[model samples]
Every structure is written in structure tokens, then in C-alpha cells.
Target: MSLLNEDATIPFISRYRKEITGNLDEVQIGEIVKFKELFEALEKRKISILKTLEEQNVLTTELSQKIHNSQDFISLEDLYLPFKKKRKTKAETARLQGLEPLAKMIMSQNVNNLEQTASKYTSKEVATIDDAMEGARFIIAEWINERTDIRNNIRRELERFATISSKIIKSKIDEEKAQKFKDYFDWNEALKNIPSHRLLAILRAENEGFIRVKIEIDSERILQRIENRIIKSQNNCSAQIEFAIQDAYKRLLFPSLSNEALSIAKEKADEDAINVFTKNLKQLLLGSPLGEKRVLAIDPGFKSGCKLVCLNEQGDLLHNENIYPHQPQNQTNEAIKKIGSLVDAYKIDAIAIGNGTASRETEELVKKIFFKDKVDVFVVSEAGASIYSASKIARDEFPNYDVTVRGSVSIGRRLQDPLAELVKIDAKSIGVGQYQHDVDQTKLKKSLDTTVESCVNTVGVNINTASESLLSYVSGIGPKLAENIVNYRNEKGSFTSRKEIKKVPRLGGKAFEQAAGFLRIKNGKNPLDNSAVHPESYVLVDKIAKDLKINIADLIGNKDILQKINLQHYVSETIGLPTLQDIVKELEKPGLDPREKAKVFSFDANIKTIADLKTGQLLPGIVNNITNFGCFVDIGIKESGLIHISNLSDTFVKDVNAIVNLQQQIIVKVLEVDVVRKRIQLALVK
Candidate 1:
């Protein structure tokens, strides 16, 4: 299969295709695609189970099937009760140990002579009828428990019947930081509804000995069914055996099974949260393309002279200089001249002022100049610009320039293209919230990696322009190979074609197979490279061209001719209907960016102060955080707003993330604006 058309999921394509992916490489994309498939398949299996049981006559086919098909495992178990089997219990053991006949004799008619039924199964071991009947009772109980169907049913039933309990098991776990997990000491939410972040937090709290949690479920009803299935009581098992079966359930089985349910539910929540975060991150990373913009970036500072860098159409810094523009000594004249000259010389249209110290002042100066010139001013978040400045990537990319200069250029590129520049910085360093640094680092990395991968695949990459930092986030490629490709590019000079990328050190045929589709080569020797068609599947194009009696170009975009051919014949171990269908879609729109359009927004000059805000005012805001509590929105003023997690959506939102994401632009109404304390309570009305 061609790499572009290779239906070999993300994992298969990435692991095998090293050479083709380049910097916006392929490692993470495969995991996401594969996981998504796995998740879908699990949902299908869940549905299949319900359908099978419904057809078997044990359940009401229509209404019961609906409950079974739902993803809620607890609800499904409720309907599975009748078909469940009775397994071996103490009662079953009593029956099996030559006492079942005696038990049945007790269940039959008026038992005036109860001694008679017990005598038949008597031996030295069961010398008395009471002992015989007791042995029979044990056998019957054992039989109930051994039934697999009954076990499955009971497991399902107990999950819903369970109650989650939390206790402040320890007071001094973190006496210094006791407040953090204090709210969790008495948690009792249902397992099915608990949010992933909260669940992980509670689990962490429990692990640290700050709290103890236990799930309490109804075992009596579950045991009763088991008893009836095995003993068939017209009046069965001297009630004493019934008590023993109940004891077995409570003492032996229920605790472990209930815990299993909790574990499974917790897993499901984590998986779901990870998936959602990954999706949001992908969208944020690969968001709209600002196009090949020529920009001048300014890193605003006080003591340090404001760093300035001008990037060309391709994002390469063409000019770099420094100017002390603010604080104790603001070189207003010198700064203006330098900036004005560069804008005029490079025909620069925009100036990206970093949102740091002296930023608004810098913007003010730029705005004054722009009032008389062609350049416009914009304020960009310098979140991870400093981090990137100190990293090895910045050193290698701008070897001759100072650290601040590189940061300024990165700030400019970020404004022009977020995903591309943000890729250069560690996701962790892009400070969007509090506690981001202290949270579980490993968990954060996994989440960030997933997000980067999803974004890279969604936006795809321009093979020619993407840097190694950006490329490393691709599904299959990692930091090492991303460096190798850059090294190869430096040694080999500019690549004029995608095929040449395969020759880079460490990149082989397998890697190329996975990454080739996503990376594009504009105006390359082979038109297919500019599109997603892999080199391996060039023959398929050739065959199609030959069969159509036309050249590859003519066969590519012709819908009428391409639609007539049957795709099933192409299916194989290497290729399937999914792949074939993808090829056809690519033929229609080659090298499409899957990201959404980035809406342009500028801070309103009149609304520069929090005091200017009015009640019930509608404004555009950027999401600065997504926390368990709420979203913090930066609404152009110096102070950010609190869209208390409750205000993120109208529904009862468990996860604040589901309603708003970091860096998302949302339209909000100022519900209660305060200037005294500098607080603005906002709501996403729509």
C-alpha cells in the first residue's frame, strides 16, 4: 500500500516509515489512530454481548437490549440476572457431599419426620440427620457459586449495588499540605460518574495514606439468586444454609469483585480523559495557518534591552538587533528608527510584541509608528518562548544569534503558526495554568505527547519547511531521529524532493513508509510527493493510469473515472477497503490541512483596563486555563476572568476541560464585572 493510502493504521505506518516523516514525524499519530480503533472495537463488543443475550430468550429482546448495548457496565449487569448460573457454595458442597437428596427431602411436603431424610445419606462422617442435612446444605451452596453465568451476572449486579465510601484514614499524611486533599476525605460519588482528574486525585490521596476508601455493594440479593438456582427451594436448605451462602458472598467474593469494578471504571475515565485532552491539544497545535508571513518580533523586557528579530517568508531570521525601549531608560527614538527601518526594508506587515514586561508599552510605540506606516501591531503570548530560548533546539537553529533574539523570532513564528513554533517548546513549559509544574510529570508527558501527535497528524506538515523540533511530534518519529534528519539536511543542503529525505542518516524504508504521506514537497520533481501518495504505491498509480489509458496526473483528480472502479479487489493483508477508500479521497483533495481556521482577534484598545468593563457586556476571551474548578479567561484587560468551571457550560459538567480548553477563543458575556478587586465573572452563553 502507498504510505498515503496505507490503511496500516498509525502504529503500523509510523514504525515502518522512518525516512518519509522527517521532522513533523509519525510516532504519536499511530498510537492515537490505533487507540481510537481499539476503543471503537470495545464499544462494538459491548453491543455484541447485549445483542447475543437478547436473542437467546433470557432477556426481553427490545427493552433489555438497550440497557445491555449501553456502555454502562453496571446497568447491563442488572438485566443479566435471570440467565446467570448458580455456582458451588457451602450449601452446594453440603448437597454434593451426599446431602443434596436429604436437602430435597427437607424441601418436600410437611417435614414432620425430618430425621428420615437425613438418615439416608448418613455415614460415620454424617452420623446424625442434622449433620447429613448440614453436609447437603454445604454442597448446594457450592453448586450455586460454581455456575459461570451466575458469577458473571452477580458480578454485574453487585457493581451497581456498591456504594463508594471515603474516610480520613490519616490526618498527618501531609500536615503541611493537608488542605489540598481535604475535600476528598469524605467523597462518595458513584464510580460511573466520577471524573478522571478527580478519580486520579482521590486515588493519589488514598495511596498517600491521607484517606481510605471502600465500596459497599449489596451481596444479599446476588447470593439469593445463586441459592435459588442451585437449591430450587420449594422450601429448600434449612434456612441455616441460606445464611452460610450469604456469608460466603460477603466474606469471600464481593469485596474483590467490587474493587475490580472500581478499577475498571477508573481506567475507563482515564482513557476517556486522555482521549479528550489529546484531541483538544491536537486542535490547538495544528490550528489555522496564518500563511507564510514576514514578521518582526519583539521580546519586551525592562533591564534587558528589548530583543528584536525579523523573520523572512520562510520563518528564517533575516535580521536581529536589540533596543532598550522601556523602564529606567526607554530608548524610544532609537527603538523606533531600528524597527521602522526593518519594516520598510523587509516590507514587514506585522509586529508581534511578546506579552512580557514593557509589552503594552512596546505595543504603544509600535502602534504610534503603525499609525504613520504600513505595519500593524499584535500582542502574542510568550508562554514558552524563554524555555525554547534556553533549549538546544534554539541554540542549533540560531547559532549566531543571542538567546533573546531567538526567543523574539520564535514569538513571531508562534503568532504566525502556533503548532509549528509551539512544537519547538516543551508542552510543559507553555505555562497556561497554576500547578501545571507540580502535577504528575510522567502523566503530563504522556498526555502532552498524545496531544502533539494528534495535532501533527491533523494539520499535517510541509515537508520542506518544518523544523526538527516540530517534526519530532509526528506519530512515529522521536527527538533522536528528528535531530538526525536536521543533521542530514544540514550536511546534504536543501532537499529539492521528498525522495531525497529517505537518504538521511537513520531513516530507512520502513520509516519512510509511515511518514511519507503527511510530509509534502511543493513543486517537487514528482507531483505525487506534493500529495500524500507514498513511493511504494507509485505502481498502483501507474497501473491505474495505464488502465485508464492516461497519465497519472489525468487519472488522479478525475472523479467520474475513479469512481467507476471497484475498490474491494485491492484489499489484501497489506491493503484493505479502508486504505483504498482513503486513496480515492486524497485524489480529490491532495495535501489538505485538517485543522480548523484560526479566527483573528485583537485586544480592543478602549478596553485596556479592567475598570472599563461593563455589566452584561459581550466580549471575546482566550481560555488561559482548564482546571478541576473552572476556566480562567484572559479578556484583553491586565486581569484575567474566572468562568468558574460551572460557567463553562450550561450542563452539569464533571470535567472543566470538556467545556473549555487552553488557548481556545470563546465568546463570553460579562455577568458580574468587578474593578475594585479586579475580578470579572464571565459565562459562555452560547
Candidate 2:
């Protein structure tokens, strides 16, 4: 808590302060952060409630202690229910009519002649004994609803035995737009057992005005339990109390508890959906990179022609043009000659083609052309390329270029390094989430931002060449500071050492401490600047080098010498064995990228569309999107095929991610194909 309160980031605390944290990993530390915030919020609410109670002159010793001891929101609210100010209700109206004394008499259960007792309360407002008894019952019902034990019992019942049901609005049942949610129009399921995606679908159906959703439990059983707890004897007073219990169950208790149950379910569903999204986003961000390759990229189309751009090793756009190799303008010979000349002229090491519209045709054309050098070919997912092209960031980066040229450059850069280019666009628009639009927007943004930050810090950033978007995700460096760093770099040329990072305007000592270790400088003045070692630990490294009679440069990457050192000898109060071990490991492989190099993937050449697919045919595919129920695989066609969880393996599969990941290449056997609907069902070939 103290570490977090001091503005230390999760990645920094987990990586640098292992001794103080007992070596907790990032996930564990993140949980601590979440609960710390929750606890602080709870404490603030408690203080407000205590102050309100004092002002109301109802702060009894027992009630104050109970409120202080309450750990969760539900329990705290239950304790405060009776004292909470409410709008004009039946009980309040009855109290205003001077019927609370009769209500109290009935609750005591000692009055044998309840009707005669009720008659004494009759007046202009309460004309008859029956009217008086009815008013008294309303007050009794309110009292019963306020009992903490009664509300808790009902909450437990709802949690264990609730059913969620949805029905279509009859007026819109036959509308064409409502057909998509028809399956949920008459749905009933156990709320506790429903999957997140299914629950979100039902909720969305209700939101769209196509259905009305309700929650239900066994009302009679719950009422009986409440009666057993409240009733003491069988008499006229017991019967009156029974009437109150029935009213409370119907009008007050069940309604409130059922809503709470539904809200809890919805919160859990949101959490599950967000977890899936963050996992997928992390995988996509950490996907393999084609590092520092000069490449020719193409965005394929038929009528608009394929937009082509050649990028240098630093991902700068060297040139861009158009080539119509397919369809109406079948200038195949001219296109091939132009591509060959561009490859030789730009010294292109690889070719990247966007996997959208006419991609296969372009791939075939490119493969047939003879090149001056050996070049690998790749098909990149252009899911959010168009979004990036029209974005303000893209416009700022290339003010003179058009969207098409910007899009082609984005595709090329995505191949070079996905994390750097993809950060410029919103994570939700990247097409790697399940029901992203339906979940809580604030929570989705926070989780995705955390995932992006973790990924960026885990693979360290290059200080000199990283974009503002990439640098902003580095620990303790935000958008404003990132812009300052870039402006400083542009004005004074590339950074020569890590110490120069502190010179950026408004970047103070604390921010530098948190961000310096994660920012690497290649071939810097100090060799450790290119490694993961923090500047605070440089003196220790210098001492180790002096003891070994070698310079800092000789100590780096010398596995034999590094292995011979006793890690305990360097351990201090602040730097323990864990930090020393990490320092040695980083020194052994300074600036080594943890991600694998990009590989070339190919689809079956004979298949182009849904019509070409046949049941029982084996084909190669790439897993594109994943959900709780199944994953969708792209098999070189417009419509990706679904591999349901049941067919993921020979045994029962609980998690779809355990079997397949995003962008994973696999061979699948077609189980069924509905060409009319463009739906293909596949099974893992295993």
C-alpha cells in the first residue's frame, strides 16, 4: 500500500521491489491495487454514513460499531436501510395517519383482540377498523423489510435459486431487425450457470426493446422461511403479522433482493467479458514482430487497385504508388515489371500483403514475379488499418499523404512491429474482443490500458525511435511527457544515452526513476543503459566490474564471469538476491527481444471463397478471434469458420484459449459448410 501510495507503478514495484513485496508477480500486485482502492472507497462511504447518523441523532454505540465493522457494500447498506430517507411511501403515509402504535401492538403478538385495538386508532383518515388494520399492516410491512436478518436471508435465496427469463415484445416479434435476437425472446436459464456471452446477449436483447427480462425464485418457500423466523404463535395477531409478511415479500423484499441479484450477475458478466478481452489484447500486442526489415507492402483491392508502399528499415515510407494486377484493368505484365523494379530499387527484404479483398490474387501475382533478392511473403490482418488511416494521429504523421497511402504504410509498419503501430489506434477498434460494445466502457478502457502498459513495459522501448503513442505507455510517462520527449529528440537529434531522458521538459526525477529501466538506448555511452538495469543500481555494477578487474563493457554478455559471481555478496538492504539475479540475467542478454521473429504463413491455394470449401476437407487456417464458447478461424476466405468448444479436442474443453490463441496457425478439418449463409463449422485436426 505504501509503495502504491508513493506513485510506484505495478510493473516497477513487481520488477524492482521484489524483497519488499515478497516477490509478488504483476497479477498479484494488480489484485492488491484493486482491493486497496475498493477498501478506500468503502472507508469513505462509512465516514459519510457515520456523519449522517450523528446529524440524525441516532448514532447508538452498537449501530456505530456495526457500521464500522461492515466489510462489504451490501452489508453496510443493509445496516443503514432503516435510517435511509425515502420518498412518500405507504408506511410513511400510515405513520402520518397515527397508525404506528397499532402496528407496534400487532408486532408484539400479545394482543388477542387485535380488531378492538385497531378500532381505537380509527379517525377521519382511518374511518373503520378494517381501514385501521390495513394501514397498520403497511407500517408492519415496512418494519419487516428493514430487518437486516430478513433481507440477508432473501438475498441468499435469490443467489442460490434464481431464474432469469426473457419474453419478446409481441408488437415487434415479427420485425426483420428483431430476428437476430429471436432465440432469446422466450429464454429461461439458471442465472448462476449462464455464460457471460449468453447473459450479455440476453441483456442486449432487453436493451434493444425486443424483450422484457425478469428474475424469479420460489416465492412461497422464501415466504415460509420468513414466517418461521418472525411468527411466535398462532393467533389474531399472528394472522395480521402474516398479512404483513405477504405484503413485504411481494411489495418490498423480493423486488429489492431480485434486482440486487440481477445486478450482481451483470457485474460478474462484465468482469468475465473484460478478462477475455484483456487476454486477447495482450496476445495481439505481444505478437511476433518482423524486426527492422525493409519491406514492400500492398493493400489489395479490385476496382481501386492495390495501394503499394515501400518502407525503409526504420519504417519510413520511401515511396508509394498503385498497381492494378487483377480485374477490369488486368495490366498483369506492367504490374509485375513495376513490382520487380520496386523490389530491386528499394532493396526490399520482405513483402507484406493485407489480408483483405483480392489478397489471394495479389499473392499469386507477387509470387510469380522474379525478384533480384530472396524475399519472404506475409499476409497481415488489416482489421483496423482503415481506422488508423483516417485518425488524427495518422493525419498528423503524414499531413500531405492521403488515407490510402497512410493505410498501406500502417500495414507495413504492423508487420515490422505490431505493438508500436497498433498503440496509435484504440484497442477496442482492433477487432480482437468479444461483445466489447456491450460491456462497461470505463472498465474496458482501464483493463485494455493496463494490458497495453504491461506489454510495453515487459518488452522495453527504444528511447530514440519509439513513437509518442508507444512511449506514452511506458511506466510513469504519459501523453504530455511523451510529446515533450519526442520534441526534445527531434530538436537535438537521437538520444546518445539514457541520462539524456531526464532532460525532457517537465520529466522529473520520479518519472525518470520509474521509466528509465524500461527505456533502452542501443549502443549507448554506458553499456548498462541498453540493458534492464536501473540507474540506481549502476554503482553496484561498477563495484562488481572493479572486483572482477574488468570494465563495465567486458562484464556485459560475459556468461562465464557472470555465473561465477556470488549473488548474495551484492545483496543490500534495498537490493536483494532477486534484484541481483535479474541484473545478471539482463546483463547476459542485453536488449534481447523476448518476442519471436515473424514467420511466413500460407493458406491452401485452391480455396478462395465459401463455395470452394467442402465438408471433410482438410485445410490450413489461422485463429482470428476467440470467445468463451468457441474461436473463429480465418481459412483464407471472406467468412471465418467457427470451431466450437465441444469440437476443440477429444475431451471436454473448459477454456477456449487453452486450446487456441489469437493469430495461431493450425490445420482444421471442415465439419460442415452452409454456403448460403456463409457459415463454416470446423474441427481441430489434431
Query: Poorest 10 consecutive residues of model 2 by lDDT?
Result: 677-686
lDDT of 1 by residue, 1-686 (tens): 24545444354354334434432234455555556655576577666656666577665657555654655544454455334444754554564466666655554434555666567778866677678866755554444444456667766775566666677866565575655787887788776667666777777777777888887766566777766754444343346556546654665556547777777866665565544445445555765555677889899887887888898878888888888877778788888888888898888867788877767677777776742455656677887888998899899888887777888988899778888888877776776533443345566577777667656766667766789877786545677877887787777766778778788778777667667766777777777776766667677767767877888777767888888867776656665555567677777677766655445556555576778888888888788665556777877767888888777776798877677666777888888976765678988865
lDDT, model 2, position 420: 94
TM-score of every prediction relative to native: 0.64, 0.97
- Among residues 3 or more apart in sequence or in different chains, the pairs in candidate 2 whose N, CA or C atoms overlap within 3 Å are none
Global fold similarity of model 1 (TM-score): 0.64
Error of 1 at 492 (Å): 2.6
Model 2: how far residue 36 lies from native, Å: 0.7
lDDT of each: 0.69, 0.93
Best by lDDT: 2
Count of backbone clashes for each model? 61, 0
Query: How close to the true structure is residue 198 of candidate 1, measured as C-alpha lDDT?
Result: 73
lDDT of 2 by residue, 194-310 (tens): 899999999988888999999999999988998999899999999989999999999999888899998899889999999989988888999899999999999999999999999
